[model samples]
Target: MGNEYRIALAGNPNTGKSTLFNALTGLRQHTGNWAGKTVSLAQGSVEYKNKTFQFIDLPGTYSLFSNSKDEEVARNYIVFEKPDVTLVVLDATSLERNFNLALQVLEMTKNVIICINLIDIAEKQGIEIKERLLTNRLGVPVIKISARNKIGFPLLLDTIDRIVTGAIECQPLVLQYPDEIEEKIRQIEPHVRAIVGDHVSARWVALRLLDGDESLLDEINRLITLKGAS
Candidate 1:
């Protein structure tokens, strides 16, 4: 992996995600924070048809549940950093929970690519994921890739370029949670601008806070303190 570019790979934990990431960037991986959150971020670069692709490997977590450190890390990057593009890598075998994270990411931002990995296992288990149906549902370019075999690398790279260049639009399906939670998110959305910006969806941040993320609370409290001083 040798190129000058930036990307972020996000997904739930234990999804063969790290293996796929290594396949994409190879020896060029590096680690750091996501600008504000102490949550660690890993990045690597690969030369894709004369274009350099840099990728940020996010901590794998189940859904965007803000109760843990990894969720906050990936959520903040998609919501605040608004990276050039976000790859929601999912384990094809576990669509239910894996998709839960993907759907959340979509709600927070527009640039997302779906990587359905481990199709081999899914087929072995007699599970068929109607790819076309899934694609139609996602409203974005979906790539069925076996990172181990490198089956769909070219398509993935091309899709990445399109998303980053704004040629392709990634739309999130607005999923309704429990009415009580939705009410809370609606209430909290307006209070986040002091800490984030217009580039992010306030409702997503509000949901995270409602789920009780310590790091997010810390950030909001810090902002409140600063605002009081000013």
Candidate 2:
């Protein structure tokens, strides 16, 4: 078999996320419901530089806090599946609203690339994004492109290639919470790490637990049970 890499596409609704997916995958895609969930998930594969990149288009969500089924499915996939690289699509016209999800994803995984879509629209509105500054701030590769116009796709693909092949290392920005929350995370993170043991992000899990996320507690117990059975 040839080398294959799994990439997760995540973004808010109406951010041109689906357009990007269709452009890359074309006819080689399928839509299906997530296991035990009614929310639809689109998946496709595209060949790039002798490598197969399978893209899982996660349900459009504004946040991964599991407020809805879409959020739950998207959050679970990133937290559990642990794709080779997570491509977070953002709307250049309204980056402030989009950054909420981007920051959450950064907390969950370090392998990420922030793709600023709809740059053409933002440019028409006299908005100029400092790509280099954003890249340095987020500590990850940030590419600006108009997915509808096929602009900057070559660079996007090459960036993905580099990330997948370990040519480029992504150092995602870590968020700092208040001192009280940080103390609680410090106390819980070690226990989470002992349980998950690098299977997932212990710090992220600790934050969820602190938020009183009962669903995540169930998931943690389930993971422990599965490991015991294995």
Candidate 3:
């Protein structure tokens, strides 16, 4: 598995994630529904710089906090699968709105690359993103690309390869909630760590608990119950 870098493509709906996937893999791709749900997942492979990169295109979702099937699929995969890098595609025309999902993903995993997609459309609409400013704000590599036109892919692939090969380091900026919420997270984090055992972000788990995410709460309870039984 280490021989090939595993990448997860995550983003909001209409962010051109599929287009980016198709552009990367061209004809080497397959699709199937996520098990137990009707949401579809697409996987593709591309060879770049003597490395094979496997891309998993997750369902489009506005935010991971939502209980929708698409949101669950995207969130669970990032948390459980722990891909080498999660390339978050964002609509350049509506970046602020799309940043919500990007921030959520950043919470779950530090390995992230923000692909500000639809540059051509943004240009047409007289919208421009200060890549350097945004990159500084996010503390991650931001690649500007028009996936439809296949622009900026060489840099994108090079960045992905560099990050996967450990040539480039990414320390993503984590979000800070309100002081009360932060206190609650600090309280819940240790329990989450005890249960998950570093399989996922304990801080993110704490945030989810505060948000009343039933799926995760149930999982935590189930794990605790199993631990007691054993």
Candidate 4:
């Protein structure tokens, strides 16, 4: 792939994430499942501004912390692979409902771009999203788009290019847990940083540990080993 940057498309089901993926990649796409799992993974490549951007359409799920196999695949790929940018697709009509996953993803990675899909439907329903408010609240770039009609994609591409090229800087919002839990996280943070060494966010690792997500813990340890080897 010659140093292609990987962009992961993540969102709830029926948010039109697949449509955007197809539009961006065109014909250079492939479909398959994650190894040893039935959860499907779709990938494609697109060239923009002299750089190749690879897109991975993760299986749609309500939450990454869920027990579904699809959630497992999406969560692991993001945590382990650590894509260059995580494109979080949100439903404009139901921003509150879709914002849950976006918030979860923000806890994991800093490089995030939120795409508000289904703007046409939202407008028809008289629901309008304040892109600037959301962008400021999340501390990430939010692009309004109607993927089915291919509206606002040019600006989306430009934003992606700028982010990947370091022209745009992103500092994602951080979520604060309860005081007791925050105390525990502070204690565990040092240990996690010692092992992972910034390969991933230490606070995220601490949260996962507190949540008792053993599968993700195993994946994190494996990634730590690979990073150490490299």
Best by lDDT: 2
User: What's the TM-score of every candidate structure?
Assistant: 0.82, 0.96, 0.91, 0.92
- CA lDDT scores, all candidates in order: 0.77, 0.92, 0.88, 0.88
lDDT of 3 by residue, 139-214 (tens): 8899999999999999999999989888888888978888999999989999889878887899999898888899
**Model 4 per-residue lDDT tens digits across residues 78-188:** 876789899999999888999999999999888899999999999999987889998898889999999999999888888888888889899999998899999999999
Residue-level lDDT of model 1, residues 60-116, one tens digit each, is 888665666667667666665667788888888888878878888788787778889
lDDT tens string, model 2, 1-230? 54899899999999999999999899999987766556677999999999999999988999999988789888988998788999999999999999999999999998899999999999999999999999999999999999999998999999999998899999988899999999999999999999899989999999999998888788779868977999
| Evaluation by TM-score, superior candidate among 3 and 4 | 4
- Top model number, TM-score: 2
Candidate 1 minimal-lDDT segment of 10 residues = 1-10
The pairs that clash in candidate 1 are 5-54, 7-54, 7-56, 13-61
Report clash pairs, candidate 4: none
User: lDDT at 12 for candidate 4?
Assistant: 97
Q: Backbone clashes per model, in order?
A: 4, 0, 0, 0
Candidate 2 similarity to native, TM-score = 0.96
lDDT of 2: 0.92
